[model samples]
Target: MAVHGRTEAQPIDLTQVRAYGDTLNDGAIALSFSLPVPYGDEAKEAARQLVRQMGLHDPQVYHAHDLGEGYTWLLVYAKSPYSVDFTKISVPKVSNHKLSHAAIEDYWHEHGGGEKLRVIGACTGDDAHTVGIDAILNYKGWRGDKGLESYKCFAVKNLGAQVENDRLLAEAAAFGADVILVSQVVTQKDCHRTNLAALVDLAEAEGARGERIFLCGGPRLSHPIALELGFDAGFGPGTVPSDVASYLVQAVVQRRRENAQPI
Candidate 1:
């Protein structure tokens, strides 16, 4: 197609995208579910009816197995007749440019010329998981990225797991921490959310909210959810040490510039 004496660029049709199986836009999907019924022919028919009620077509009970205790596991193949406008979807994400371990060190050297960034990390509340905090704060980092402790620009203290939020804040005050890193792994009954929000609220009440950056990480945490919960940033699963390091450096540098201080 030509527009205004120029050929128009071809754009993908994203408004009606569907799951692909053997071909594009086939809408073919495989679903697995368990039912409290015996593994038999009746279970297969029941699975098909359930798929039909879900608005899918041509439900095929390809596999049905006995899970014992009157339970049946079923795999169904079906075609969905629905689609979503991919172009209109929007999601909040961390906007900082990812930096390598070496680059982060170099950037801190160039921009952060004063005292090292003080970081205090802990697995607050009843959550006793330390793997996430250890990955970002320990010398032996997760997956091969050197942790913040390895960086000359940061002084990190990993307080292990299940530390009370009040203790975390008090320790941060004593350490004069510039950033607070929180890790919560056990989120049963939304306890992680409650614990995280309580920390932020306490910080605000103690007048430490403005002087420090608050970060959180876990399997359930996301950048958007963290912002909503009053955190400076959030890191989810698969986050490496360098990811948090880069963001800290950039954020501190920007904050210094905004305060009319040397970076």
Candidate 2:
């Protein structure tokens, strides 16, 4: 229980915690969604009543817009009367160790010596979104971080969007790439899954198993999902060039050591 804008000192319980909006434990919340109903007075009332039915109190319909053809988008603010066990929640994540752009280049040159690490990246399948891959591989980083292209140590080959998995594998073989990066942005009907899986399966069919590193990245990609899909790693939202560069360079160094090659 709370008043005004402060939390009332109560027993700390993570097992069941309510949302905090105007005050601590207030259970206040906000949500926006599109409903199948047309926008009108009835739609607003429907939204308010809907929130109330969900155990929320003081439901307020903030905004509602008709999205044409009997569809309405709405924003609602209300107080929820439920909570969950925060202590039992866990999410898998990628590498905790991130390398600087300079560090990545320095490590590659100092470790790899004469051979520059070759990396091939592409947006395989019918997904033609190049923005994601371009941001990581292009020199002018997407949101401020310089891409792998800016790094002097890596030989990056970005084949752009809508590349075929078989072509990617052929290029990987011809280029003798040390890392294979696949990006899929169009996830309509979970097509990213099928496209990414095809790349992995094709690489295996080509007998390139255990040779180069396989990495998948996109908005829908996750480390756990990538691992399960037979990839060495996966990169998702907010992933910068340095993060991918760090992992690939480190993995390459490890591989070099395992092969008794100087790195």
Candidate 3:
């Protein structure tokens, strides 16, 4: 949480707190969950008693529903009767360089950038899921007004689900792509590791290894892991188009400068 105002209240120490729920004035909490039981007044009372037994005070069952068959859902409000400090806590985060959309466009245009940036995206191997890849490449942006297609500087070719390694490389070479986005959803049996390594190996064999940026995305992919596997960067869940676009434009500009520099 970002601090915006000063208060006389002593800072709450969240690090030592073992509570998890909404902080109400009287330590009250409202929760919902399902149970495999028949719905009725008896069941509702049982749920209230269960909450009370779980250390809450004066548990009250506000609603209960029969979710067909024997499954029942219940909503309960109860007093947790506990409080804690709220300020002493911290979490690790990625520190990638943040660049605005205009900045990216400016950098690219300054460094031989009118040529449409070619990007190839695929869900490699037998991982037939396309949701992750589509989230980044699809013209219809996800979670608001943001996606790769929104950027006019990039020409993306998203090869949806179940793409083979050989096919991806062939297309990248054919398209003269400047970047390759690989999405690996199935990590079972370390298939993700093997597939990622194969792409890098193929790129090296084709002499396009370091000439283009290689990006990986998945539920489990991370920056450190992608770097270890020879990728330029990694994006996990919650990645937007702007994030990838920023990195690609900056990287392309830097590469152009390095190649043009006379030794």
What's model 1's overall lDDT? 0.89
Per-model TM-score, in order, reads 0.81, 0.79, 0.63
Q: Name the weakest run of 10 consecutive residues (lDDT summed) in model 2.
A: 1-10
lDDT scores of the candidates, listed in order: 0.89, 0.86, 0.79
| RMSD of each candidate relative to the true structure | 5.6, 3.6, 7.1
Which model is ahead, 1 or 3, in terms of TM-score? Answer: 1
| Among all candidates shown, the one with the greatest lDDT | 1
Clashes per candidate (backbone, < 3 Å): 0, 1, 5
Candidate 1's residue-wise lDDT over 199-249, tens digit each? 999999998887788999999999999999999899999999989998998
Backbone clash total, candidate 3: 5
Show model 2 residue runs off by greater than 4 Å.
1-5, 8-12, 41-60, 78-82, 205-209, 255-263
> Which candidate order results from sorting by TM-score in descending order?
1, 2, 3
lDDT of 3 by residue, 153-260 (tens): 778899998898889988988988889999999999999999999989988988888778899999999887888898888888778777887888777666667777
Local accuracy of candidate 2 as per-residue lDDT tens digits, 1-263? 45555646656578987897776677889988888998899898888888888888998888999999998999999988889999999876665468887888788778887788999999989988899999999999778999888888888899988899889988988998999999988889989998888777877887885788899999989999998888888999998888898998888888778878755
Sorted on lDDT, best first, the list reads 1, 2, 3
